[model samples]
Target chain A: MKKLVQDDIRTGVFICDCGSNIAGYLEMKELVEFAKTLPNVVFVQENLYTCSEGGINEIKLAIPRENLNRVVVASCTPRTHEPLFMSACEEGGLNPYLFEMANIRDQCSWVHMREREAGTQRAKVQIAMAVAKAAKLRELNRIQLSLSHRALVIGGGVAGMSAALALANMGYEVDLVEKRDRLGGILNELNMILPSNEPPDKLVNNLAARLHDNPKVTIHTGAVVTKTEGYVGNYVATIRQNENENKIKCGAVIVAIGAQPLKPEGLYNYDGKKVITHIELESKLKQGDVQAKNISIIQCVGSRSKERTYCSRICCMTAVKNAILFKEASPDTKITIFYRDMQMYGVENEQLFRKSKRLGVRYVTYDPDRPPRFDGESVSVHHLRMGRDIIVPTDLLVLSTPLVAQDDASEISTMLKVPINENGFFLEGHVKLKPLDFATDGVYLCGNARFPSTIREAISQGLGVASRAAGVLSKEALFTSGIVADINPETCCGCLGCVAVCPYGAINFIENRGICQVNKVLCKGCGGCAATCPSGSARLDGFSNQQIYAQIEQAMAV
Target chain B: MSDSQFEPKIVGFLCNWCAYAGADLAGVSRLQYPPNMRTIRTLCSATVGPHQILKAFQKGADGVFVGG
Candidate 1:
C-alpha cells in the first residue's frame, strides 16, 4: 500500500440530491462549486442519490480518477449511510476510516425546507466542514482478537440448563456452574409446573438427566465463580467448588441466576405455619396436606409499594395457578384471592385465571393504601366493587410476594463488568432490539435474573440467550472498532481523570509508568475520556482534536 | 448586534445516539427550523469540550448548542 502525506491529501466530495429531498430545497449547483474551494478538495460531484448503486459507482470511479485519499459524502445522516460510503471507499482501495459525512438531507435541506437561500448557504458550510475534517482524517486499522469456542454458564436453574443444552447441541463445549449442591433452582421448591400440570421435580429431573447425559456439557454443582476477567471472545473465570478452584476459559458467559421470592416475614402477619407464602403453599399442595376449607390468598404483599415500586410480573399468574389447583383437588374448599389487580397476562395465564373463576374461586380487588387486615384468626378486606368492607374467615393465608434479585447479583455484575437496573435485575443491551444481551459483549442475561419471567418465557429466553452466545462463539475472531481512545505516553499525567470518566472501564492507570492506557477492546468510543483529560493526553482516534478543530474553523468561515 | 438586524451564527454539537437521530427524524418528518446553526456530530455530548464552544464564539458564532 502506498502512503500519502498531508500535502498529497486529495478529498472527493459527493453531494447527494436524495431524489430532490436535498436538491429541491438547497441550491446543489452552488454547493458543489463551494466544495471545490475548500482546502484539499480536489474533486466535487452531485448525484441524484449518493446512497444508490449508480451514485456509489460514481464515487468508486472518482477515487482512482481523482487520486482521492479521503472521501466526503454530503447526503443523509452518517448514522445510516456512513457505512455504505465507507465500504465504497474500501472497495476503491482507499482506507475506509478516511471518510467523513455531511448530513444535508436530514439536518440541512429537510429541516430548512422553506428557507431556500439560507438552506443552500447552510449546505455549503456543512460541505466545507466535512471537507475540512476529511483532510485531517487518518487511516485507522481494526484490532482483531482470537476467540475461545467454549462457553461458561453461571447458575444451574431451568434457564441455565436450557441454555447449556442448546449450546451443547450446537457443538460447543459448555461448563455449567451452580452455587447450590443440586440443580433445578427454584423448580425444586415448586409443587407443580403449570400448563403441563406435572410436578416441578419431573421437569427438573428430565432437564437434569438430559444435561448429565450430554457429552459436551460439564456440570459443576456446589460451585461459585470467584473471579471473572477479560472481555468478549475470551474470558478467564475462576470457579470455586468446596476446597478446589478451577479456572475455566470460555468465549461467552450466560447469567441465569434466577431470583428468589420475597419472604414477606413481618408483613401480612407471615408466621410460617398459618400465614405462609406461595412457595410454602407449593410444598403443602405437593404433600396434599390442605386441612383448611376456607383459604384466602393476598397478592402483592412486598412489591409495588413505596419501597419496591416494580410490579412482579409473574406473581399474579402463580396465585391464579395455585388457586386453580387447590379448587380442583378440593371442590368444596372456598378460596378467595384479594388482589390489587389480577395481572393474568398471556393466553395460558388468562385461561387459567378464567378456569379458577369457573371452579368457584372468588376474586376481590383491594386498594394498596387500605391493605387487608389479618388478625390472628380471620382476614378483613375493603372491597372496591361492593362499596363496603367484606370479612372473609380464612384458615390458610397465602401471601403472593414478588421475586427479588439474587443476593449475589451485584457481586456478579461487578465481576462480569455488567450492569443491573435499579430493581437489581440485570440490564440488557437494549430493551427491545437486544433483549438477551448485556451492553458488555460476550455476557448474556435470561430468566428471573433479567426480570420476573414465566417458565415459558424463561425457557425461550434461555434458548434465545444461547443463540446470542453462539453469535460470538461461532465467530473466528472479534474485531474492535478503530475509533477507540488512545492516551499519549509522552504527555504523561498520572491523574486518574480519564479512568474516573470512562464508563466502559477501558482506561487503566499503569502504576509504575504514571499514565493511563486504554484497553482498546473494552472501549466503546464514547470519547468521554478524551474530553475529560485535563492534560490533553487522551484522544479518540476518529474524532481527534485536530479534525474537530478543522471542522470548527471551516464552520465559522460561512 | 441589534436584535432586529441580527442573524445568529450558531454551532451545534449533537451526540450521535439521541440528539442527532432526533434531528434526522425532524427532517424525515419535514419539520422546518431555521438554518442558522451548523452541526458537528460527536460520539457523545462529552466529546464536545469547552474549547470547541469557545472557539466557535471566537470565530464569530453568536450561540453554541450542545445536545446529547
Candidate 2:
C-alpha cells in the first residue's frame, strides 16, 4: 500500500464538458484556467466526456506521466459516477479513496443554465474546493477481514427456506432458524396460492423435505437469535432453543423473520367470529370447514388509511384469490369483493382477477370515505356507480388486512444494529441499488421483513439475498473502507463522547490509559465520532479537520 | 439584499449521505438556487466541527450552512 505524504501532494483535476451539457451553460476554458491556479494542482485537463473511454484513458495515462497521487474529477453526481472515476484512478496506480468529485454538470451548469456568468463563477469555486480537499487527501488501503463460509438464515418460512437452500446448494453451510416449532411459517396456515390455486402445503412440504435432506443445512425449530456481536465477515450469534443457548459463527446473516397479519379488532365490527381476518378464513377454507352460502371480503381493512399510509401490496390479490376459491368450492356460494382499487400488479394477478370475474364473483368498487358498514350478519355499502346504499346479507365477512411488522422487530433491529423504516419494516441499504442488503455490510434482508410481499416475491428475494450473502462468504476476505475514525492518544481527553456517538460501536474507552481507542475493523468511516470528540483527538483518516479546514478556507477565499 | 454587485461568498458543509445527495438531486431535477454558496463534502454532518464553521466565517465567508 502506498502512503500519501501530504506535503509532497501532486493533485490532478479533470474537468468534463459532458457533451455541452455543462459547456452550454458555462465557459469551460475559464474553469480550467482557474483550476490550475489552485495550490498543489500540478495537472489540469478538460474532456468532452470524462466518463467516456478516451477520457478514462487520458486519466489512466496521466497518473504516472505527471506523478499525480491525488485525482479530482469535476463531472456529474458522485452517486452515479463516483465508482467509475474511482476505478479509473485505481487503474492509474492511485488509491481509489484518494479521489474526489465535484458536480459541475448537475449541481452547477444544469441547474443554473440561464446564469452563465454566475454558474461559471460557482463552478470555479466548486473546482477550487475540490482541489483544496485533494491537496490534503491521504491514500488508504482497504481493511480486509476473513469470512467464516457459513450463513445464518433467521426464518424458516418460504423466504427463509429458499435462502437456506440457495446457500446450501452453493456449497456453503447454512443454519435455518424458525421461531415456531414447524418450518413452514405462515404458509402452513394459507389454503391455496393464487393463479395456479396450488396447495400451500405441497410447496412447504417440498421445501421442508429438501432442507431436511441437505447435509449442509441445519434446521433449528423454535429457535430465536438472542444475541449478536462483531461486524461483517465475522458475526457471532447466540441462538436459544429448548431452554439451551447455542453459539454460531457465520460470515453473513439473512433476516427473513416475515410479518404477522394485522388484526382489525374494532374497525368494521370485527369479532374474529362473524367478521374474521383473512388468515382465519384461509385456515377454514383449507380445512373444507367454511359453510357460508354468502361470503363478503373487504379490502384495505387496516391499510391505505391515515394511520397506515402504504398499500399492503398483496392483500388485494389475496382477496381476489380467496373470492375465487369460494366460488370454486360451491357454485351456489355467492362471493362479493369490495375494494377501492384492484392492485393486481403482474400478469398472473391480473389473470387471477379476470378468472375470479369469469367465475361469477361480484366485484364492487367503493369509495374509501364511504366505507362499508358491517352489522354482524350483513354489510351496507354505498354503491359509487349506482349512487345508492345497498345492503348485502352475508354469513361470513372476511377483512383483508395488511401484514404488520412483528412486535419484536425493534428488539431484533437493536441486537443487529440495523434500522427499521417508519413503517417498521427493515430498511434496505438503497431502494434500488442495494435492495437485498442492509446499510450494515454483513446483514441482508428479504421477504415481508422488508415489506409486504407474496410467497413468490419472497422466494425471489430469498434467492437474491442468498446470492448477496454468498458473495461475501465465497470471498477469501471482505475489505471495508479504510477512511475510518482514528484516535490520537497524544491529544486525548477520555470523555467517551466518541464512544456514545458512534453508531457502529467502533470506539472504546481505554480504561487504563484514560484515552479512547478506535476499532478500525468495525468503523464504517462515517466520522460521527470525529466531530463529537471534544478534545479533537478523534479524526477520520482521509477527512481530517485540517483537510476540511483547507477546503473551507479556499472555498470562501475571494 | 438589493446590492447586485455584492455577491456573498457563502460556505456550505454538506454530508456525503444526505445533503450531498440532495444537492445532486436538485441538479438532476434542474432545480435552480442561489450560486453564491461553495460546498465542501464531509462524511457526515457530525464530522463538521464548530471550528470549521468559525474558520469559514473568519476567512470572510458572508454566511455558512452546515447540512447533513
Candidate 3:
C-alpha cells in the first residue's frame, strides 16, 4: 500500500460521455473546463467512454505524466463502476483506495435531461466536490485472514443431512448437529411425499445412511449450538449436549433447523383427536391409527391471515397429497378439500391435482371473510363459486396449517447477527440472486427455516447452500474492507457512546488506556460508531471528517 | 413575481446500498425533479455525522436530506 502524502496530492479528474448517455444531456466540454479550476486538480480530460479499454489506458498513462496521486472519475454510479476504476488506478502504480467517484450521469445529466443548463451547472458542482474530496483521499490497506476448511451444519433433517453429504463429498470435514435423539426431522412424522407418492422414510433414510457412513461427516445428536463467535472464514461454535460442552471451529455454517408445523387449536375446533393438524394426521396415518369415512381437509389454516400475511408455499400441495392418499386407501370414503386458492405449482403438482380430481376428490372454494365453521360433528363452508352454503358431515377434520418459524429463530438470528423477516423466517441476502446465502458472509440458510418448502425444494436448497458454503471454504484467505472506524486515544474520553451505538459490537473501551477501541476486522465500515461518538473521537479511515467537510463546503460554493 | 427564482439549495447524503440505487433508478426511468440538490455518496447512512449536516446548513444549504 502507498501512503499519499500532503505534498503529493495531485488529483487528475476524468469525465466520461458514456457514448452520449451523459453527453446528450449535458455539455462535457464546459464541465472539463470547470473541473480544472478546482484545487489540486492538475489534469482534466474527457472521454467518449471512460469504462472502455482506451479510456482506461488514457488514465494509466496520465498518472505518471501528470504526477497524479489521486484520481477522480465523474461518471456512472460507484456501486457498479467503482471497482473497475479502482483496479485501473492500481494498474497505474497508484493506491486503489486513492480513487474517488462522482456520479454525474445518474445524479445530474440523466436526471435533468430537459434542463441542460441546470444539468451542466450541477455536473460542475459535483465535479468540484469530487476534487475537494480527492485532495483529502488516503491510501488504505486490505486485511487478509486465513480460513478453516471445516464446516458446521446445523440440524440433521433432510436439508441438513443433504448439505452435510454434499460438503463431505467435496472432501471437506462437516459436523452435523441435531437437537433430537434421531436424525430425521419433520420427515419422520410424514407418511408419503407429494409429486412422487413415495414414502418420505425412504428419502430420509437414504440421506441418513450416507451421512452416517461418510468418513468426513460427524453426527452430533441431542446437541444445541450454545454460542458462536468470530466472522467469515473463521467461526467458533460451542455445542452442548446433555452435560457436556464441545467447541468446533469451522469456516462456514448452514442453518437448516427447519420449522415447526402450526397447530390451529381453538380456531378450527381442534381437540387434537377428532379435529387435528396435518402433522398429527400424518403421524396417525403412518401408524395406521386413523379410521374415518368422511374427511374434510381445510387449507390456509393459520396462514395468509391478517397476522401472518405470507403464503405458506407448500400447504396446498400437502393437503392435495393427503386427500389423494385417503381416496386411494378407501375408494368409498368421501374426501372434501375446502380452500381459498389451490397453489398447485409445477407440472408434477398440477398433474397430481388433476389425478386427485379424477379419483373423485371434491374441491370447494371458500372465502376468507366467511371461513368454515366446525359445529361439533360437521363443517359448514360458504362456497364462493356457488354463492351458497355447503354442509358436510365430518368424521375426521384435518387442518392444513402453515409452518411457523422455530422458537429459537430470533435467538439464532441474534447470535449469527443475521436478520429475520416479519413472518419470522430467516432473511436471505437476495430473494433471486442469493437464495440460500445470508446477508452475513459465512452463514447460509435453507429449507423451512427460510420459508415453508416441499421435500424437493428443501433438498434443492440444501444442495445450493452446500455449493455456496464451499465457495467460501475453498478460498485460501478472506480479504475485508480497510475503511474501518478508528478511535483517537487523545480525543476519546471513554464516554462509551460509540460502544452503545455500534450495531456490530465492534467498539470496546480499553480500561487500561481509558479510551474506546474498534476491532477493524469486525467493523463493517458503516460509520455508526463514528457518527454516534459525542467527542468526535471515532473516525472512519478513508471517509474522514476532513474529506466529508471538504465535499460539503464545495457543494455550497458559488 | 420576483426577478430571481428561489431555487432550494439542498445537500443530500445518499448511502451506497439503497438510496444510491434508487437515485440511479430514477435517472434510468427518466423521472424529473427540481435540479437544486447536490449529492454526497457514503458507504452507509450511519457514516454521516451530525457535523456533516450542520456543516451543509452552515455553508448556506436551504435543506438537507440523509438517505439510506
Candidate 4:
C-alpha cells in the first residue's frame, strides 16, 4: 500500500442542474450550493448539460487555476457518464480513475417522483456515500501479466468447431474439448441449416476435419473441464477427456456450452412418441403429410422465468420456419402458432412474418398470465382481443420451448470464478462494450451458454471470443487495472474474508504467516475486498478507501 | 418553455434483449423518444448491474422506467 500523502488535495464538485432534469423537482441550486460547503471542495459549479464540452472545459479550467487533484460529478447513471467525467478530470490534469461519479438521476429522482423532499433527501445521502467512496480513490497503474498464446474451447459443436478453426487459422493453438463422444452436439440433432437448406452435419464435419488435420489444434472428445482455475492470460484448467484426466495451461477459455431443448414434464404427458418437440416435428414434416388434419405449435411453453424467463431468442424464428413447413406440405391441415409475441425482428423476418400470414399459417397471441392449455387431443387458448377462448383440435402438439443454459453452469462458474445471471446464463463484462468478456479475465462465454442464441449468433459469439482471445494472446505483455486486491500484512488478522468475496479466487491466506496475498493475475480490483474487510486491511490498488475518503473530505471542505 | 412542460420523461432500463436493442433500432431508424426518453443498457432485464435505476431517480427525472 502507498503511504497516505497529505498534499492539500483540492477537489472540484460539479452539481449539475441538467436543465431542471435535476432542478425541477429537487432544488439543484440548493444542491450546488450545498456542494460548495463540503470539505476540500475548492470549486463548486452547476451546468445545464455537464456532458457538454463546455462543462467539461469548466472542469479542465478549474484544475489549473485551483490545483484540484480530485473531482466529483452529481449527475445521471455513472454507467452512461462516468467515463465522460473521468476524461474531463484527466483533461483537467487529475487522474481519471481518481474521479468518483455520484449517480443522482436514476437512483433518486426518477423512482421517487411521488415524494420530492424524500427523493432529494435520499439523493443527498447517496451523493454523500459516493463522495465517501470516491474520497479514497487512488492513482492506479495497469497490472501486466505474461500470457500463453493458446485457446481452450469447450463443447465440440458447430460453435466450438468454428471457433477452433477460426483461432487455428489465425495461427493460435486450439484445444477443442467436447463432452459428447461425437463432435456435434445439437448439430447431430439437425438435418440442415435454415434458409440455405444445407446439411449442418456436413458443415460441422468439414470444420472438425480441419481441426483434426491441423497440428496447432488438439481435439478432445468426450471431455469436460472438471476444475477450472486462474484469471486472464494464464489459467490452469483440468479436464477429464475420454476417461483420462489432465490439466492444460492456456491463456484463454471459451465457454460455448450450447443449449439443451426444454422438454416439459407432464405437459401433454409428452412421451416423446405422442407429444414431441420441434426436432421430432421436423422429422415428421420431412416424411410428408400426416393423416391428421390439425397440428398446433405452442410457443413459450417452458420459457420467459419461474416457468422459464428468457425470450429463447430463436424460438419465434424456429416456430415461423416450422409453421412455413406445415403450410407447404398439407394445405388442408391447420397449423396455428399460439404465441405471446412473434419476435420476427429483422427485415427478412418481417418478410417471413408476412409470408406466413399469406400462407394461411395462423399466428395467435395468447396472454402470458392465462396461457394456452392442452387437453391431450386439443389445445384451449383464451384470446384477449376477441374476448373468447377458442379450442383447436390437433393430431400433433409441438411445444417450441427455448434452448436453456446447461445444468452445469453454476459448477462451471464456480470453477472459473465468473457470475451467472439470474436466468443462470453467464454474465458479460458490459452488455454493450465487452459483450463476450466475463468480469473475470481470460474466461470468455459464447453460444447458448451466454444466452439462448440461434446457431448463427452462437457461431458469431464463438468467433468473436476467438478474435478477442487472439488479441490478448498476440500481446507480448498483458496489462490490466492494477486496481486488484492487495493485502496489508501488518493488519492481517489471518481470517479469510477476502477469499470468499473474491469472485475470481484471487485472494488467499498463505500458510504459517496466516496473511492474505493477492494473486495479481486473478484480482479484478472491484474493491469487494474492502467492503468485506473487518480490520480495514484489504484494499484495491487505485480505488483505495483512504484516497476516496480524502477526496470526499476535500470536496466537502470546499 | 415547452421543455419544462409536463411531458412524461421516460427513463428506460432496457435489457439487451428485445427491449434495449429495440430502443437502438428505434434510434437507428430515428425513432424519436419525445426527446425526453433516455436509456441505460443492462446485461438483461434480470440484473440491472449497479444501482443505476436509483441514480436515475435521484437525478430528478420525472419517472424512471424499465423495458425488456
Scored against the true structure, residue A218 in model 1 reaches a CA lDDT of 95
TM-score of 1: 0.90
Query: Higher TM-score: candidate 2 or 3?
Result: 3
Which regions in candidate 1 have their CA more than 4 angstroms from the true location?
Answer: A1-7, A19-24, A53-57, A486-518, A526-539, B17-33, B44-54, B63-68
lDDT of 3 by residue, A1-558 (tens): 113235657999999999999999998888988887777778999999999999999899999889899999999988889989998998999999899998999888888989999999999888888888988878898888898999999888889988999999999999999999989899998989876668988998888988889999999999999899998889999999998998999999999999999878678778899899888999899999988999999899898999888889888888888888888888888999999999998999999999999999999888899999998789998888788998999999999989999999999888888999997899999999888999889999999998988888888989989999999999988888878989999999999999998888898789998999998888899888878888888999778779999888888884
Model 2: native contacts recovered, as a fraction: 0.82
lDDT of 1 by residue, A193-311 (tens): 78889898888899999999999999999999999988888899999999899898999999999999998979877898899999998888788877988899999999999989999
Candidate 4 chain A lDDT trough over 10 residues, lowest sum:
A549-558
Worst 10 residues of 1 chain A by lDDT: A1-10
DockQ of each: 0.77, 0.78, 0.77, 0.03
Q: Return the top candidate by DockQ.
A: 2
Steric clash pairs (candidate 2): none
Candidates in order: C-alpha RMSD to true structure? 3.7, 3.5, 3.3, 10.3
For residues A46-143, what per-residue lDDT tens digits would candidate 4 score against the true structure? 88878888888988898888888878888876656777887788777888877876656654455455557655665565455455455566776666
Candidate with the greatest TM-score versus the true structure: 3
Per-residue lDDT for A182 in model 3? 87
TM-scores for all predictions: 0.90, 0.92, 0.92, 0.65
Model 1: interface root-mean-square deviation in Å: 0.8
